[model samples]
Target: MALSLDTIGPDTKNTAKGRLEPAMPPENRLEMPTQSLGRWSASQERKPVVDRSRWRTYLARLFVFGGGLILTGYGTYEMYQVVSVSRTTVLQWLLVALFTVNFSWIAVAFTSALLGFFALLSQSRGRGPLPTTLSCRTAIVMPVYNEQTSRTYAALEAIHESVEATGLGAHFDYFILSDTTDPEAWIAEERAFLALRQRLGPQARFFYRHREKNHHRKAGNIADFVMRWGGHYEHMLVLDADSLMTGECIVRLAAAMEADPDAGIIQSLPLIINRNTLFARLQQFAARVTGPVIAMGLSVWMGRDGNYWGHNAIIRTRAFADQAGLPDLKGRPPFGGHILSHDFVEAALLRRAGWDVYMLADLDGSYEESPPSLIDLSARDRRWCQGNLQHMRVIGAKGLKLPTRQHFATGIMSYLASPFWLFQLIVGIALVLQTTYIRPEYFARDFRLYPIWPRFDPERALALFALTMGILLAPKIFGTLLMLLRGHERRASGGGIRVVLSSLIEIILSALLAPILMLIQSGSVFQILLGRDTGWQPQRRDDGSIPLRDIVRRHRWHTVLGLLSGISAFMIATSLFLWMSPTILGLLLAIPLSWLSGQLGAGLALKRLGLLRTPEEFRPPAIAIRANELQQRNATFGYDDQDGLLSLYCDPELRERHVEMLSPTSRRKRGEIETDRALAEAKLGDAETIEDVLAWLKPKERIAILKDPALLTRLVGLKSGTSAIKAAE
Candidate 1:
């Protein structure tokens, strides 16, 4: 909370406060000294990294499973009766009954499935020998644009040290891809980069390149590198400005890739370990604890052609180059010139070309930072949502095959899952109608000997119920088992039995929060689909948490609905008295859900009570901190200092105006362009020589101006000094 200042100030000042890495180039170019892919004599399809069966077989199974689920759902829904509301007594009861049985199955099963998947992955981690052979050259690209050079390099240094420990450090190179425009910061980056290279020596490579004209945002930044130096390396591992990974995991991924030659990509599921904010911590914990099973199930299904998040992933460079050229969707924001969300598209493209993309859930030592607040994550999601929606264009693209279709569907699912929440509202209304109106048989005179049960057919009910259980609950059940088997439930989780209990509580709380998020996400999706534009807005990177007021304000609608549901349940269940009170009381559960959207969640509770501390387990190594520049070096004319931070000793526009002030030749033109400050700052009467003009300035500044001699040569003052005297005559 105390560190929130610099990240939240006015945009201009925030930019100013962060020290910029020194200038490398205005035009960003990613050039490496290594040989191109075309230059290599080795087969482009060589299997140096991944074992073929593990990669390819996984891909085949995932598609079959996902495709089967989609097909089954559509088939079952089509066969079911389409209800037309009619006042007929039996028909209305049937409609309400149908809604209760089917809808609950879908909702409950989905939750169960999520839990089961994590269990499966935890189990997988304990059993398998992770791929460890190091045969591929992987370039870890860290793309930075006006970020803190010290912290960025520190994180990179931490990773570099981790990498050396793996003994495969020679296989990986670090690229500090600078996109900063500030001359001083640019210079700082250059100096830091050089320092890092010196420390890393030959095994660890450091590259510094700049782009003067930034066009395509982050995607284009990487694309530029692909075009320039992409051919030199076999694969590229991407990290954001704030991303960090352990060296051992890096080697493991490479080993996995080498062990399986067919693997086109390996996506490392990142854990957020540094976040202290409420919004992020919730996301971080959910991702860390709840994540493994889902990732495991996903890994189980998606052997190859899995999701490719923009960061913490390794890509086969040659295959990517040959197949990953993303066609610009012609239009405005959301559906823009360059693909904003190009990772999925690229993955799909690679798969279409018969390459395998794998999601490695078992790997660790990879870490990523999170947005400190809700508004921040939402802002980031807005861009992603729009970009994924654009992938709809690629779904129909001629050659992509079935895997691409499924991948695109997965992308849409990222935001579209919210719409399904609307179904719950419909089901809840049906629950009210059925309970209140359809009186239980013999409710008036229930004999002690036998009570009549509400009737629905056993076979139809059982079939639908089985499918629902398999799809939803199975994943969660599997996850729990995985953790137990892997021994992580006892080892990794600091809370012994207490941690498992906490996780269960977290899951239940998260489930209620889901509906509320569903509402928000659904609306956000609609806005994008309707052509609303989002931006490359920076996410909040501070440690300060979300406020409770924000939660209440944002999710109040859920609270209102919850109260209404509770009330409606009571009125219906009154006939059954306290027997039905629990169902009705579920409405009061909304209060906790609403609070979760605020600071009352475990994230904030942990920070306050120091209960769920993530520990200071994550930080960059000392070498990285020392190697990165704290003070920016300024350019002192002559040789443009590679290590110098660039500060404008003179603005060309300002100098040009001064030139006009010196001349009688362009006096009218000069006055038109000059600002009041420049005019006020201007001194008209000078002793006339360059030396005389230089006398008015401070020693360092004056010498700086003189150091660039051509500046004196081209000044309008000298050009028109003789002209001014002639004109006076």
Candidate 2:
């Protein structure tokens, strides 16, 4: 047999392949690693595990982080206390009455706090009621193409098995909803769904549908499902390809829907729990632990008003259909295209129509696997940015209520949260210094020494500290108690010292990651707002280690921002740091923290020392038992070898390896055009349908290809349309 990496390729770490080319050039990419390709040495190919000596190994970061959390909790409490007191006792002699009035300051702070409070309440601990009788015959929808049906089906089957295990599987159905453009993958999905249907018998209803036209990508595929089979059920539960929620949670979502007929949507916080690479592992750990506090806080605050994330949520059919009609954009690509981020707007629409949208906080067993690497996460975010930005158009459209506007505003600002935080933190430092160093002012009610503007009276400081600590720590206490009250912590947290310690460790890591992420998300959000795009890229779905150069390439701007941020902090706030050592240290740590934000340094170091190795024990049992079957992912990519392979084509390990093995040079020679074209055509074979032919087009230029050669060829074959294909091959 020829050296064919066309199957899983040489970079066979996880199901989703990794890089097959040289590191992305700095000019073309941002927020990537430094030494990208060489990071994953041959010996490091495996999955992530809890560092047994995690303490021993990551000891330096652990103590630094644990100490940092204490400082954050303590300092934020103190800092906010200062702000609250100052806000209440307005300065007497002020140059600007606007500053004295604190109009915008109070407006934004209370607005954020108010919104935060609402968001907090929305993640309430209590379940409204469980369904005594299943009112809605549900269909849990999973869509996939040639990409990775096995992983998709596996997650679907796991969820199905989980539901069946509950004995309520009969009320629920499974749809392997596909917009797959590949014959092999689509055929595999058909066979798999049939097998699943057979295996489940009548315990569960299983259906598989693949659209001949995958017009709107995910949204289009889903709309097709609703248009066709939606009427059969009152509600539908949707899952992304990488999403896997345990059985009990799906049942709970259904039950919640049944219990509350007025509830238009109930979204489970689809947190990431398991991943293999260091980046994915860190994210997964953070989501599982910090997620509850943040989620519960938001849910408690949001109450019956919440935005819908695209998947891992249950939605009411009639309500969504009635209110959530999406109109195509007339503008340019990216934003003007179809509504990419449809979940939030649909939720907003549902609420506008007077239905409740709830986000359940501690809905146990709701889980998902993380994007296996940082590169994957960034790619997904790019698509989401485009989708969510499209909603900016819907914000001002008539008929949306105040709460609906709140949701939309929240959605738009969520991406900008990072940018906002970055600006606030920088300005906050400046304001802090001005207050201390600038000339003191006499306030209306003060006595002794004339205090600074918005005077940092110590009493005011204490109260803010207490209030903030309560807000931040309350969720942890609340989540722990609820689980303990439910008597499920042992199962939920993994029990004993290991679980408790893990939770603490997770919190610390999360804190370190936050500011860095704040920068990334800010850049991402603002870039979207500015119409500077991070395009639709697929995630890294495997356990391969990333090279340093890769990190530098992807995230150079981050490096630049971190270095600048740290330098500024040192320059302007040198005195304040000496006053508050911890805060100063935290501020100073921005450089290294930003550098290692993705745990890029740690991952590299781990691989070098054989510390970050993926353990076999962590591999899914399915992969071990069905090794041959698992590795037999003959899923063809929906790509054309024409135009020297688009970015994503070379992104996947399998395709990249195939290209390398097929031809050593990444670039194809001009004279070999006919030869390679023949090879590519041979691989395409006779595309079963014109749709398959189109899926392989330069995905970015999908619209431009309407007047394409292949389409003309098909039209010529039709003998009914004008235009002809010149190729006789």
Candidate number of the best TM-score: 1
Regions more than 4 Å wrong, model 2: 1-136, 165-171, 180-205, 246-261, 269-271, 276-286, 293-306, 333-335, 359-363, 373-375, 382-390, 428-500, 564-573, 576-729
lDDT of each: 0.55, 0.52
User: lDDT per residue, candidate 1, 1-729, as tens digits?
Assistant: 121212111221122222233212233233323212122222333333434456545543545464555645643553242232222234334444544444444443354345345345435234255444566688888988866665677777778777876666888877877666443455446445544554555445666666543567777777777777786778888898877777777777777766666778899988776665555666665666556766765666566657788898888777777767666676776665667788887787666666888787777667777776555566677787888888776677655546568778767766766655455345545544664576655542635343333333335545654665465545444544444454544345443454455456556555555555555677778898787777665455556545666756655665676567566656666533343333333334544444443343446666554333332222333333333332122122111221120111122322332232221321234334434223222422443543344334433333223223333343334322333323422
Tens-digit lDDT string for candidate 2 (1-729): 111124212223222222222211111111211111112233322221221232331432233334445544554444544565444333222212222222222233332333333344454456555444565688788867455555666666667666776777778877776666543444345444444444455445666555555776776677667765677778889888777776667888888887776788899886664454556655655554445555654564466667788888998876666656666666766567567777776776667666778887667656566665555566676676666667777777555555567666656665655555455555556566566567656664546464546545567545654554454554444434433343344444444444455445445655655655665676667676677645444455655555667765665665565556556556666644443343334334544443454554465454444322222222333323232243344222211112212221222332232222221232334455443344335434555533344455443233222212343233223211112111211
TM-score of each: 0.65, 0.61
**lDDT of candidate 1 vs native?**
0.55
User: What are the candidates' C-alpha RMSDs?
Assistant: 11.6, 15.9
